[model samples]
Target: MDTTVAADHAKLAEELPLDQIDVSDPALYQQDVWRPYFRRLRRDAPVHYCAESPVGPFWSITKHKDIVDVEVNHRVFSSSSTLGGIVLRDRPADLELPMFIAMDPPKHEAQRKVVQPIVSPENLDNLKDLIRGRIRTTLDSLPIGETFDWVDRVSIELTAQMLATLFDFPFEDRRKLSFWSDASTALPYAGTIVESEEQREEIFRECLGYFMTLWNERVNAEPRPDLISMLAHGEATRTMSPREFLGNILLLIVGGNDTTRNSMSGGVLFLSQNPEEFAKLRARPELVDSMVPEIIRYQTPIAYMRRTALEDAEIGGKTIRKSEKVAMWYISGNRDEDAIEEPDRFLIDRPRPRQHLSFGFGIHRCVGKHLAEMQLKLLWEDILRRGWTIEVLGEPKRVFSSFIHGFTEMRVRISEPR
Candidate 1:
């Protein structure tokens, strides 16, 4: 965390007010020293307000219970794009793209149901064999005893393959999905990913053009099992406008890519950092079941989800006025001591590990939650079954976004295959 960019932007003096703290600073997360920052908030001011910052003023809800309260009460805090959608940065009014997750119920529920069957129990059962096969194929292809970017070789590859399967996207061109997902969330200030807003929008436009080709094809084809087909044929979603469909396509792509990929990449790095935990897992391989959820909790892929106050509401003793942007910092809540005992440490086996907010909660609680978990569970199951262990060769290059909390590259080597 040497001279981190976040600390510089969020310059604070000893006497500075807590409202001056801006957790939306991407550098804090990029440097991975946001623990103390969030810890300070949870201890001193659970529902603190930042009067102003790069992404604008918003109340930072750091407590787990408080975030859950806001999530469950969607009426008071709307997930509508007319307000601000989910992220702290409000969408441009002129270019507003409406996705089902960003919409309230009735319409939201209607659109979400079309894709729900794709990740349902039966669909996961259908996807399990495909996911496991990809995991096996991907791991076996890694070079033995050679340093490589785990995020590229394993994380992105596996997740992108799944995304391609979901949208029935072209396998060779599947990397485009990851590219668009990255571009969608990369803030203009985050120099590491997309350099500017123009660049981001250009990538997004390209993404829409490519997906529109598939949308046209899917609309004519007989109903299939993939997401695009589900949306094309489903009663509620089939009538969506082009931009609305593009919005949902981007949503599914990002949702499918970020969380599981980061957890996959992060889990390997975690074991390397905690060798004893690695040994413990090797000794008790069944812990992968527990470890999967713990990894999701630990990494907390999407850092925060924003909601606009629909009415005057009180939370954590703060009176949030109507139409004010309120950000539920899921990353902070996942690490809140009140929520999880020994929140700092990454313990593979923990009681009620799934209680964390990695997949979020309420109506917008990740439609692909089951699919993401299956991808991870099958991954570790394969790793443990083969008695292989990966060792981190260098520190990870994290994604430069407070929103999509994840890795871009992680150097590692296959250390043992006994």
Candidate 2:
């Protein structure tokens, strides 16, 4: 670290006390040492403030109940794009893609309803066979005795395939969905995924152009069950502007891919780290139903969501000013003991597994929550049925982003343990 930057961090930590804690640093997450930092905040300052950081000044809502309070009270804690959108960082002005998750009430509902049916329970049931088949083929292809990147072979591939199916995109080029999701959320300066903001925008334009061709086709043809067709024909979304259309498409693609992909990889890593939990799961494969939420809870993809205050409000003894950015740290809250029993443990068959805040709460909760859960449930059920086992071989390389809580690489072997 630069001397000035290090000195500055120290100065802030001293002067601001616990208020100076900035959990948004990507390095904190990448190193997998963020637990202690959040523990400090939850114990001393559940609604603490950091006057400055890479993303800028913001409040960290660390405890579970406090985060849910921010999520439910939408009127006071606005998620409007006009304020700042959902991430801890502000969306680029020149490239603001106004998706509904960032908007409030009626507009959010109207736009969301347009494409919501694609992942409805009935549709999910219809798609189960296909998802299971794909998962089986991908797992069966792995070499049993040799190590391979579980992320590339299984995690990314399954999620990307599902996303391609959702968008009805060409299956051969499906990895492009994962590529686009990474480029869209990653910062160029972060040195993690994309190199620069201009390059990132260029990739996004290509994504939009590809989708536009599909949009033109869908509008001219008969209605279909695919997402593009639904958006092209739905009364609420058919007349959307190019920016709005791009926003919605990006939202669906990223929302549909990243969470499940990481959670799949996270599940293996967590189990390997907690062998007793794995024993419990393996002993009773039927526990797959309960295991799904525990995996999501332990992984906690998309760590923190940001909301801008519409008015002054008091939370945890601190007063938040209007227009201030307040982050609901779902990752921290999921591990908050006040909201869960032994929040740090990785038990697979906990009685109240879903009690954690992974899918979030209230209106803005993840739209694909059910689908993501189903994917994990089915993945585990298939793994157990085949009597297959995986051994984590080495330290996992985590995604270098505070927002996308996931793995970039994890070496694993599919053979039986010695």
Candidate 3:
């Protein structure tokens, strides 16, 4: 961000009335100027309320400890899809998709357990060689000395392949995984990837139909290690309705694709912008161990997680009434100064890099976190070994969403060939 523009934002943030501060605008994230607004919110009102917005009324929890308090008290802060799922915007009544993440209590636990083995320490160990081989092949194929989209060629492709592997989906059709994941989270605004809810529903039906074929094939077969097979054979998930099945499939797809993919693009961008940190990392390749989590904390792929208050609750001394929405802004919490030292700096060598809220907290904490970390750790390790000089040509085209904080395009070039 330009110094003058940043100053202007800070000025506006201070001048704006407390009631007029709405951080829910997708533009704030798309333009990459959300810092000042969030900084003001953290300082002034950690549990701030916006009574009106495009996404409707909601409260924002900006501080780290406050966000964690909401996360741990999932009973009070309900994630029920009926109340309004995990995003600030409520899905249209007819199009509601009830996945386990949006369910409360025993149901959430039962369904979550069905897919837990996919990221088991044993499964992750089994996947190491496969993941590394794919990473090697993808890295080796980058166009030397030419500018290209890191998001498409590297980030999306790599994670798509991983998602395909996890679900045992058709490898040749792997790009569909990313396409459907995008559609699943896209805001139905004019000129956006998804233009309307009807279009989104059409895309959802297509995704569900494709996955249903695999489900039928797997459900009748012997149990296997793949996610589809696991779900098909697991007592809790085997009899899920078509909509519930689709919902879980979309959840796994987004969970698998976004976190690792965006972090991959973010690592390259962050390192390019901070040459000193990049130089230090290059000098000590072992720093990849800590750098991986730092990338996640800084990028914060999924910006916020929404939960509705089941009853009156106190957070940061504010009362949240029954059935009202609350957004735990992980992006803001990760940058909370009280929780993280030098919160805004992209420091890879922080003593406790993994303590951030990118993967969230409590039972709803990302089940694939270790897998995401392993993917990043392996990619960075390989990048160091290959010695390619990557440079970001310009600012990335960010996703037009406050929910999925990611890049749509990040142009980069290998300035020096390996």
Against the hidden reference, what TM-scores do the models get? 0.95, 0.94, 0.98
The candidate that wins on lDDT is: 3
- Model 1 clashing-pair count: 1
Query: What is candidate 2's lDDT per residue for 219-263, written digit by digit as tens?
Result: 999999999999999998999998889889999998998889999
Q: Is candidate 1 or candidate 3 better by lDDT?
A: 3
- Top-TM-score structure, candidate number: 3
TM-score of 2: 0.94
lDDT over C-alpha atoms for residue 239 of model 1: 88
Ten-residue region with minimum lDDT total, candidate 3: 1-10
lDDT of 1: 0.87
Provide the clashing-pair count of each candidate structure. 1, 0, 0
Clashing pairs in 2: none
CA deviation > 4 Å runs, candidate 3: 2-4
Candidates in descending lDDT order: 3, 1, 2
Query: Candidate 3 local accuracy as lDDT?
Result: 0.93
Candidate 2 lDDT: 0.87
Q: Tell me how far the alpha carbon of residue 298 in candidate 3 is from the true structure, in angstroms, after superposition.
A: 0.4
